[model samples]
Target chain A: MTKLTHRRLSPHILNRLIEGAPDESLALTDDHRRSLTARFRAVASNDHRRLDAWMVERAGLPYEPFRWSPASARRVVGNAALRRSLSEPTLTRGDAVALEVSDQLLRATSGYARPGSLASWLAQSSPSVVGLVSAEAANWATQLDEAAQELERPWSVAPSDAYYDVARARTTLRGRRDLIVPRGLTRVVLRVRAGAPGKSAGPGLRADLTIDALAEPTGLAASRVIGLWPEAGVVLSVDGTMEDLRAGARDLVRTAVAWQRHRLARAA
Target chain B: MTSLLDTTPVSVMDVLRGERDARPIANTTAASGLRAELEDGIFALLGPARRDAPLAIRASTLRSGTYAEDLTASLLAQVRGLLVTQALRLLSVGLEIDHAFDDALLAWRADVGSNELTRFVDQLESDERARLATDVTAHCVTLKRSLGPLSSRWLPRTSLRAYQRLAGGDVVLRDVIDLMVGTTTSDQASVALLDVTTSPLGEGAERVMRYHALVQTLRTSIVPLRTSMFSTAAGELWSANVDDELLSRAVGDVLETLRVMTVAP
Candidate 1:
């Protein structure tokens, strides 16, 4: 004759009962039965409200949501392929240049300030490629935060306790050494549906393509830049010298544009 | 069709009608039931007897009676009469001698019990019965002469010593007949009775035969059941080879699962 409440029969208790009880023993005592009836009514009411909320959200949806167009799809694909090649076990100077170009692209479109709950869900569900995507996203977000801080204080770039070592290096070994100076890296932010069709780069993709370029001791003083290209199929950071950098940048552009072409072909 | 005085004596007729002061038998129905029960018991004890033997006929005759002792005695006499009758009948049946012999034997056995006067007269003891013995011997000789041509091939083989032994009348013919019939029929019936008794253990002939056939058919059917899974393209992708042990284990698992599922709540 003990009274039972819905609160007492929590989800844990319910799960245990479902797992342990025989199929025929589903009957509940009078008080527990009454509580279940009331709980079901509350759930039904909440479901109705949730449906209405969804309808309102859909009504207020934007018409043109994407900032980046599919015009750069092929470029993104080429940059991604080059980046993969550079990160291989066997690395040459040429591979290093490609890596630098990839790194530059990765830094440029860095959007690390974004929330992580959605990405974490993707990581859990699609375990294969999530780790790399997450790393790229975090790097981009950090770069963006640093860029914002740099803009706030311009004098911070001068040789103080923070910039003195870098400055001394530049002056002491002036033209004798190929002193590599690490430039600001770009971060590319992209939103992708995991396990998408065809190439990795797609339209509606976003990422901070950071171009972290190392300054060579050449008269031109061109920084080694790498771009993070987060496209439909892959998140890539392309890096190289000025000449190689141009090639990597063009590759990213090609991937983004080809997305539309691929889409059209599929539709046809 | 002939008058009783011409065909058979007046005394024989009197004896047949029970007018000679013989005691009427008691509890004939109960006695018959007992005889049947005894026959059943005997058959339950022993197995089947050899065919065409005196033991088998004697057993059959004993099975047909109310009075056990009389039934036994009559059975022995009938068997002997059958042999004699068959020998006589064979002459006329010629080339179909075996068939004619068997038919004569059957007819003689059937009539043996009803011809009580002839049996009684044969059993009589009279030292001054020289005239009666001569008459009986004359009748026997006439019968033998009529049967001679039929038995000509085999009579030479039968010894006078065997005939004398049969006529000595010292053996309790009734007891001998009872034992022979009882042992032979009992032997035949024992096999069937044992089968019925052990039937609950599923060891009976019928059950054993059925199980044997079922096992063979099941063996054949299982091969096709396993092979059919590989006929489709999708099926080929998932094809797994099943050995006898694995198949048996799978079947056992399913049976165990069903047993658990069906347990009373």
Candidate 2:
């Protein structure tokens, strides 16, 4: 199964999360993808709905998409701004940078692409909504930038949250990776959590890495899946080995199965 | 009679940061020793840990009836606190927002989602909403003035939570700091904390602020530079610099609080 070689992540030392990451990468193989697809197809039902970690955890919840609020608005704005800051090495972190990133996002998505998304949300949002989004987003971005200070300069923000569809599996697996760093031939994937990481955080981190890998077009897998909960000043780093991939694959299959069972039971 | 504005112009940031001429020195204390004392006190109160029967004592629970047992008032307080919190998420970011009540109301409604509070608010009459609006407006005006400009350099993080388990996990002390500014990266003990309340800074305000400082100290193993409270009701600020004496007083307050609860009639 998946294992954490080093269990200790010192919160006492500031910016210890990215500074103490593992330096190993998993080589991509066609066999891995084929195995994952086969395993998913074996138990996959005709649910056809997107089965993300969130839906898998709370299958009973009938709806996932709710009306946009300050909380969700902040996430949308924060994710985009953080993505920009990480990608461009020279970009400094501040209000001016965040606002510039936000405006760039609005202009870039002015076309048919990302219509009815963050751009539209900001365009039509009231001054209060916009103001709150900007403020909250700035806080999250600043916190993340501070936490990743010691990390190497050439950091690449994951373009966007990704998803994978196994052919004939009839369901999709979604993963939202925040930042990615190149570790030689392999990569280091990171997810910045909003608050403190609790008991379920470990498994969630592995599952997220699995989903992101599955969604990635590149054949290469990450060296590790790093989880950062900045508020508590803590980091959880789990190694991405072959067993890690297998564990993530099995977890995704189990989620599909559980969702299938839950939906079927509800129908009955 | 002369108006207050004629005499002086004061901002919340000014008071919180201390005098314009003199910046308050960062104070440090033995966080481990103080935490041990608080944990030992809890152990004395509730001996022998029962893992199944763990107790969660909130900062509010330390106070008397105002924050206890009464469901309606507690629920009302929760709603009010959440609204102000949402408003701060805006104000703390340097948003030049107008109509504080309306802004916070929308924020509260949007952030709260569909819950009992949402239903309760939805069921309120026009006149009730008007009254809430008036009260919230007054509070937001004061809060907006006092919170001042947060920006990014201060590294403002809001709604930060701390959970400290004592007595072998039998007693849990939980607290949420409304806004935490400054940085812990430096060695000068440069962390400053603020607890915001929509209610007046009444008798229990200091107790709440102390509990927050205590939990933060135990959780981070770093003493805060300053711990303060601001009341939207009175537009007033109260502060206690972090030092040995303040922490010692906080530890005693917590122990006495637990004793009263353990020996309840």
- Per-model fnat list: 0.00, 0.32
After TM-score superposition, the amount by which residue B39's alpha carbon in candidate 2 deviates from its true location, in angstroms, is: 4.2
Off by over 4 Å in 1: A1-116, A119-222, A225-240, B1-265
> Whole-model lDDT for model 1 versus the true structure?
0.23
lDDT of 1 by residue, A217-259 (tens): 1212122211111111112211222333333223323332343
* Candidate 2 local lDDT, A1-268, one digit each (tens): 5675323223333234444555666654678878877877887465575766555444324565566665666655676776666566455444544565368456746664365666666666666666666666666666655545546435766777768887776767777677777766777777777655666576667677777777768755677878766544456767777777767667667777776777788789
| Deviation (Å) of A209 in candidate 1 | 7.0
For model 2, state the Cα shift of residue B91 in Å: 2.4
Model 1 C-alpha lDDT per residue in residues B1-265, reported as the tens digit of each score = 8755556322211221222233222111222232233344334333344323222111122222222332444433443433433233222223233333233333333223236544554565664234443433333333333222321111111100000001111110110100000010111111000000100122122222222111211211211111101101011111122234433433233223223322424
The candidates score, on chain A by TM-score, as follows: 0.20, 0.80
Pairs with backbone N, CA or C atoms under 3 Å apart (clashes), candidate 2: none
lDDT measured at residue A103 in model 1 versus the true structure, 0 to 100 = 47
